[model samples]
Target: MRTLRASVLARFSARASSTLAFDSTSHLDSLQHTRIQDLRSALFKGGAPSRIWAHYTNILNYFNYDVLPLELHQQVLRQCSPPVRSVRLSDAKRLAQGKRLEHRHLHEGRFQAIISNIRALGCTPSLDDYHFILEHFAAVGYHVGCHQVYQEIIHLGLTPQTKTFGLCLQAIAHRLTLPTFEVFRMRLVSQTRKALDDLMSDMRRFNVPFTTANLDLALRIFKETVDEEGLNKLVKWTYGIDLDNPDCSPLDLLENQTTSSPQPFSTHALNTIIDTLGRFGDISKVVQAFEVLSQPLPQAKQYRFSSFDDEDDFGVPVHVPSPSNHSLPYALPNTTTYSMLLRHISRARHSTLARHYLIQAFKLDRQ
Candidate 1:
């Protein structure tokens, strides 16, 4: 019985020794990972010693985060340096390309650690850095969290003087539904007028041409704020017409009657006016605006026909009896009488009558 007890004790001691060996191996592996992360961090810092990158690459090849403790994993990332310019442009490019290629292998804890460090430092990251983090989050298909990062930047008040804020705004704008527009308006209005003004000024100063779709958005907002008279003034002003100039009406500007070279309003601006008119249900006013657009002025010469065979010839002319001459005892031929009446109506550009004739022709064809 004593021999059996001694044998059992020896077996237990051997198992304990094996467990200790395993633990020691794990601790060494953990230490190596920490060292590797430290090397990677050093490589990112702007003024690190030249030998660091080589060691970083070597350590990166061996370290695996799957088995590491969460705390140690974080420690690894915390030890890393911020990205910096490489010794050579090619080296920098290589680093970028490598990151692009291997970014998928990046651990989430490491990223969180880096971000926490960035926040703690209270330094606004470069646009590239922000975009990198954004892309990282996006690649994981986690848009909600990505938006939170943008919100964080705004909350921290680190978004000033950065195009990243504009990019974030644009992204949110694109994703915004009608239901979200109110929220967008509230948030945008909450920004300081200086910030808003700076954004607008940058847009103009950079000559950054906005798309028609984006301009439509601006027009929608503008329409919501301005009354009819104010809107009309805006339209005229956009065409370089001064409303305060008693000599120039909106029509005069449309006609390019000003002394300066005629600078017509853009098609987008014109469309905005047309849309505004339609939204107000001013169909007749819209037609009047079209007429004003169609009319030939000094700036826009009317085309005249020199000869029937000329390419520029408009069409053949038709003669019509005067309205006073319609009282004839001798009845005119039915076709000729109707043709003369139609010619007179056409000369007057009677669109209602023209449509009536078109409908009658269609009915006659059906018959």
Candidate 2:
């Protein structure tokens, strides 16, 4: 039994020595030194994830390792330096206090750098991370940044949630749309209109919730393009109203509460409808739109109306239409509403109707 144990111990010692000799003689030390040098080169670059990743690849190649350890990968990512424009908490607070325009640019650059670094490190950003970037771009009205983030999210094999999808639509719309100018009008107005319609259709296809803001975006497109057919369909979906139905007036749609609760229309929405009608519809259509705006909303909801707090030198308060109180049981027509009505009346070449509305507008303003 002692001879057997001695034999086993000798075999173990011989195997260990052979392993050590192979490691010493087979360029293992040189390979290790190369890896250390690569790591140092990567780290000394001051936090560039791509450079670090490349260095890591070199180390793997030298060692004939297919992949780095996950722990080491993460360590390299954590050590990477953030971009210079990334605002610290205190710097952000200061920027917020000052309300500088550059804040948006700073945030945009930071998000870009973060996403690039994350990708360089082979890390997949989650939905929440992508949403944060998208929302920031949307808030800042930087449609280009929004699109860049959106494309990256798609490329990452991730599905966009409802809000992300909505933001993408908004970003695309903002990019395609240009401010209307009298001197140099945009030539792509028709193309933009088509794109907007397609986006709205996509929203419906995806079953995105029809929030007020989303509806407003759709409505704005309809108004801009004078797509009355589209507007009617939108109204039918949003408020369950069919304007063509013989029994229902536009005001009736707002008044009848027997069905599901109608989403309240903003004064801006009312104005948009009136404006659209003024541009394309006949005299009767404009009149119908005006009457709807003139109707007072339920007293409970009246406070939704925005007040013009400014007073004349005589202390006479301006009685403008409340912005939110488009429906009424006491809705007043705002200047915009009156202007739309008058413009249409004049366009129809109806002198008597124009005069009538003008006089009524003056009376309402005085009140």
| Best prediction by lDDT | 2
Candidate 2, superposed: residue stretches over 4 Å from native: 1-125, 132-162, 176-191, 245-261, 281-283, 296-332
Model 1 lDDT per residue over 15-126, tens place: 9999999999999878786876666465455334334534533554665433333343333343333332221233336456653222221344445545554444554444
Q: Candidate 2 lDDT, tens digit per residue, 1-367?
A: 9999999999999999999899886677777777766777667666565676567656656663323444454445444424323423434565468643332334454445445545566677677777766655554345556656766776788865667766755654543343334443344446445555654565555555567776777776666667677778777666554545412434544555324445665677677677776766657876865664457424534455444556666789876643333333213568988888888888889999999889988998898
Model 1, TM vs. native: 0.33
> TM-scores across all candidates?
0.33, 0.50
- Model-by-model lDDT, in order? 0.44, 0.60
Evaluate candidate 2 by giving its C-alpha RMSD to the native, one decimal: 14.6
RMSD of each: 20.6, 14.6
Scored against the true structure, residue 9 in model 1 reaches a CA lDDT of 100
